[model samples]
Target: MKLNRLELDFFRNYSHVEATFHPRVNLIYGDNAQGKTNLLEAIAYLSSARSHRARYDRELIMLNEPQGYIKGEVDSRERTFILEAKLNRGKTRQLWSNGLRLKTAGELAGILTTVLFCPEDLYLIREGASARRRFLDGAICQLRPRYAQALAEYNRLYEHKTRILRDWQENPSLLDTLDDFNLRMAQFGARIIHYRAHFVRRLGEQAPAIHADFSGGREQLGLRYETVSTVQDPLGSVQDIFESLLKHQESHRRAELDSRQCLSGPHKDDLVVELDGQSAKQFGSQGQTRTAALSLKLAQREIFQQETGEWPVLLLDDVLSELDGKRQSFVLNRIQGGQVFITCCEPEKLDGLERGKSFQIQGGTILSQRSV
Candidate 1:
């Protein structure tokens, strides 16, 4: 996947800006807080439904502005497509593709897959389990739309089941409804777990070598899916796990009271990153953590390529300055023939990269594009 042109209006600091991008690499350079990273964020928002940096939609719009708009032309898998996103408070966010309105966001997932590497991503190892879970969900959502749908349904079922549980506590007569909710949620939850397990298994296969290259063979990296429920020989099929989970929901409901539902399920699942025999979150050094995160993202791009028959667009938000020469070179070499959007404060930091296009950012305006 590659973005060919980007247009932003009232997005962050940019009032109106349009730029075309090279297929291989496009670098945006400026001082800190000059909207260099905001350009990348706009692209990410266009690809996905949400902003990569902002916690909410109102923050993404220019101050005192009613809405923010992003439009982009992209090429993926031998087809060219156009995507547009509009963010407005107090109304549902709207999306359009090729000038047609989209009823759902899942329609936009596979059209422009992206792997974003931001400075905050380095905290994946040290942060809570939710961050790691978000990473896996975001990556898989792009490749498999069903995973996204299942996750959404599971969340809804979880909320419904929690409400039913509250009613059951009061009357004890809603047990049947509670059981029905549990069975439905377990069915979908099992499917999500199946996909997550397969995703982590694939990452395990690809991340070790990449991590070794980044860490100079000093550590071995491993990825594992941590689920609360156990799967016996039925691991081959999620249907089997669903049946097993349903069969035990009655007992689980009576014994488990810490939360609204049983704790042993995909909702509580986690992705464990290990270095050698130790947990990376607990034992890895600062550099080790960052390198491991970088390797995981690179592996994600390759996995998306192998599974989808196309490369995902890579977004590097001011990450080049954080890496040493060898590590930067390793990342740059791996991204050949793929579209890349990188943000940096100093153009001199990217001197060794070959055949790249550079754009200067001042405030919210982008200067002329040049080849360096």
Candidate 2:
């Protein structure tokens, strides 16, 4: 997949801008805070209908602007599509594909898949479980709309169950709805567990080899999906996972009531990273941890290509500057055969890369464009 053209109005620092991109690699160079990352953020929004850095759409709007707009022309699988998004300050965002309004953001997935890598992702190995779970969910949500829907339902159920548990003492009547919420949670949570387990399994199959190569065959990488203890086999049928979750919820009923917290289910799931049979988070060195994180992201790209028959657009947002020379070389070498956008401060960093397109950004505008 490739973004052939992009236009932004009142998005981030850009008041009005438009640029064309090459199909292979596009290098965006500028000084810090000159809108390099903001350009990438716009493309990311077009791909996923959400911003990776901003929590609210209003944050993406330029100062003093009531709304922002993003439009992109995408080329994927011998077809062309126009993706558009309108962000408002105090209202819901609007999304469109080829002039047809989309009712839900989930419908935008798989249209222009993207795998974004930022400096923060280098800490994926050492971060908390929430970060790891987000990595899994982000990738799966792009490929499977059903998984996204199930995840949303499960989160809603989890919140309701937590409220019931927290206030049951004051209003004992709340106990009446606890079982209903638990059953719904288990139903949706089981699907989530199943999808996550399967995705992790596929990721595990691809990441180890890449990690070995990145480590020069000196280390072996491993990934383990950790779910509720009662789940005997995460990759099993939905009925099996549902029954297991329900059983575990029953087992933890008293403890949950005492603690007044929802404590059972896949919401607490984690993906364990092991390097040579050791916990990477706790035992791996800085360089080793970074390599493992890089390997995992590359593996994600490979998995997308394997499942979709096309490489997802790769976004490297000021990440190369954070890596050493060796790691940088390894990353650039492996990210071939796909549409890539790399944001950096130094143009020399891309000296050895194949001639693609290069753009200079200043004050939220594309100052110039040329062949690299």
Candidate 3:
């Protein structure tokens, strides 16, 4: 998958900008807050229909603008297609692919997948379980439509159940339907766990090898999917897992009520990472964590290619600058065979990369486009 062309209007700081892209490597360089990352975000959004930075669609629009637009002419599976997203402040947002309306963001999955490694991702190994879960969700949602649907439904049920748990004392009527919510949530949660288990298994195959090479065989990375204990086998059938989920939910029901929180689902799942048989979250150093995180992302990209038979676009958003010379070289070496966008504060940061187009961005506009 590749984004051949992009156009932005009233999005972020860009009033209007259009540019063609290099399929191999496109470098975006500029000073801070000059929209380099914004351009990458626009391309990434076409696949996931989400901004990695912004929580709300309206925040992606320019100040005082009624709407913002992002359009990409993409090449996927050797065919050309147009993806469009319109963000409105007061009204609903719209997504379209090749002129037909897309009902949900999940519809955009798998068409143009992206493996994004940003500065914040450097802390993945040490961050809490929620961040690792997001790592799984972001990658899986783009690759599996069924997993995406299950996750969305499970999230909705979680929200509903949380409100019920939090307010049942004041409004006892909310308790009337809690059992129904639990059953349905277990159904979806089971599916999500099944998918996550399989995906993390794939990661297990790739990430450790990559990390071993990255660490010069000094560290052996290990991965295991961690979920509620009652669900003994995450890879089991949906019915079996669903029953286990319901059982676990019952076990935690009283604890949840006491704490007034929803804490009894796959929503609390984690990807346990170990380095040399030690918990990476607790023992990994800064450099080790960042390298492990990079390995995980590159492994994710490899998994995407293996599943889809094509390379997903890779976006390295200011992550190269965070790495030391050797680690940066490691990332640059592994990122070939696919379209890549690298953002940095200056063009010199991309000195080792050869043969690509470089865009100088300033004030949300492309100041220049030149071959590097």
How are the candidates ranked when ordered by lDDT, highest leading?
2, 3, 1
Candidate 2 collision pairs: none
Clashes of 2: 0
| TM-score leaderboard ranking | 3, 2, 1
lDDT tens per residue, model 1, 195-279: 8888888898899999997778989998878775545533358888777667556557666544645555577778889999789
Q: RMSD per prediction, one decimal?
A: 2.6, 1.5, 1.0
Model 2 scores a TM of 0.96
Tens digits of per-residue lDDT for model 2 on 1-372?
A: 899999999999999999999999999998999999999899988876767788789999999999999999999768899999999999999999999998877787788989999999999999999989988988988888888789878888888998999999999999999999999999999999999999999999999999999888999999999999999999999999999999999999999999999999998999999999999999999999999999999999999999889999999999999999999999999998989999999989679987899999998889999987
lDDT per residue as tens, model 3, 5-83: 9999999999999999998999999999999888988888899887788878999999999999999998897788899
Q: Residue 46: error of model 2 in Å?
A: 2.1
Q: How accurate is candidate 2 locally (lDDT)?
A: 0.93
Q: Once model 3 is optimally superposed onto the true structure by TM-score, how far is the C-alpha of residue 130 displaced, in angstroms? A: 0.9
Q: Largest TM-score belongs to which candidate? A: 3
Judged by TM-score relative to the true structure, which candidate is superior, 1 or 3? 3
Point to the candidate with the largest lDDT: 2
- Cand. 3 Cα-lDDT: 0.91
lDDT of all the models against the reference?
A: 0.82, 0.93, 0.91
